[model samples]
Target: MATNFKIERRSAGGVRVLALDGYLDAHTAPLFESAIQEEAQAGNRRIAVDCTKLSYISSAGLGVFMSFIEELREAGGDIKLASIAPKVYQVFDVLGFPALFDMLETVEEAVAKFAEGPREG
Candidate 1:
C-alpha cells in the first residue's frame, strides 16, 4: 500500500510547527522539502516538526532535514522535533539527530524552547 503523507502547519509563538503524518519517502520528501523551503524563504526561522503520526521515513526524507538545519541555524534559527513516534525516532537516533537538533517530548515544549530564545552558542 502506498503511504499517504500529509503536512499541516501552524505558528507557535515565534516558531512554525509542521505536523507530519504517514510515510516520508523519496516520493514524499519533496513535499516536506517544499514546506521547509517555504518556511525558510518566508523568513520564518524557528521551526518544530511534530511526528506523532508519522509511520515511516526513507533516507531521502532524512536528507531533507540535513539539507536545511545549517542554513537555518546560521540565520539564528533552528528546527526542533517533537512528538516523534518511536519508529521514526529510531531512524533519527541512528543518524545522531538528537545531537544535531533539539528533540523535545511535545510540540508545546519545542515551541517553549523557542520562547526562551536560541541557546548560548
Candidate 2:
C-alpha cells in the first residue's frame, strides 16, 4: 500500500467532496474505492473528487472510478472530478473520462454542477 496516499472527506452543500492527496495507484485504489463505497451506502449520491493535491494516478486508480460510476449514475448521483493537476488530468483525458464525467476546475464548480441537476449523456 502507498504510504503517501491520503483521502479527506468533507461536504460542499449537498455534495460530498473527497479530497485526494498523494499518489493513486494499485496499492492505494482500494482505499479510495472504500471511501466512495461508504458514501454511496449512506445514500449520498452527489460526489465530487477534489484532486487539487493528487499528484499521480494509475490505471488501477482509474478503475475504481469506473467501477462505481454507473451504479452512482443509476442511483441519481454522480462523481464529478475537480482541481486535477495537468499531469493527472492527462491520464483521465487519455482514457476518455472528460466525455463521461464532469471534470471541473474547482471543487466549488463540481458542487455547483449538482445543483444544475442530473447530468445527461
- Which digits, one per residue and each the tens of the lDDT, describe model 1 over residues 8-50? 9998787899999998999999999999999999999899999
TM-score winner: 2
lDDT of 1 at 90: 93
lDDT (Cα, tens digit) per residue for candidate 2, span 1-121:
2288999999879999999999999999999999999999999989999999999999999999999999999999999999999999999999899999999999999999999988987
Pairs of residues clashing in candidate 2: none
lDDT for predicted candidate 2 compared with the true structure: 0.94
- Candidate 1: residue 38 lDDT (0-100): 98
What's the TM for model 2? 0.97
Cα lDDT listed for each candidate: 0.90, 0.94
Error of 1 at 76 (Å): 0.8
Candidate 1 runs further than 4 Å off: 1-3
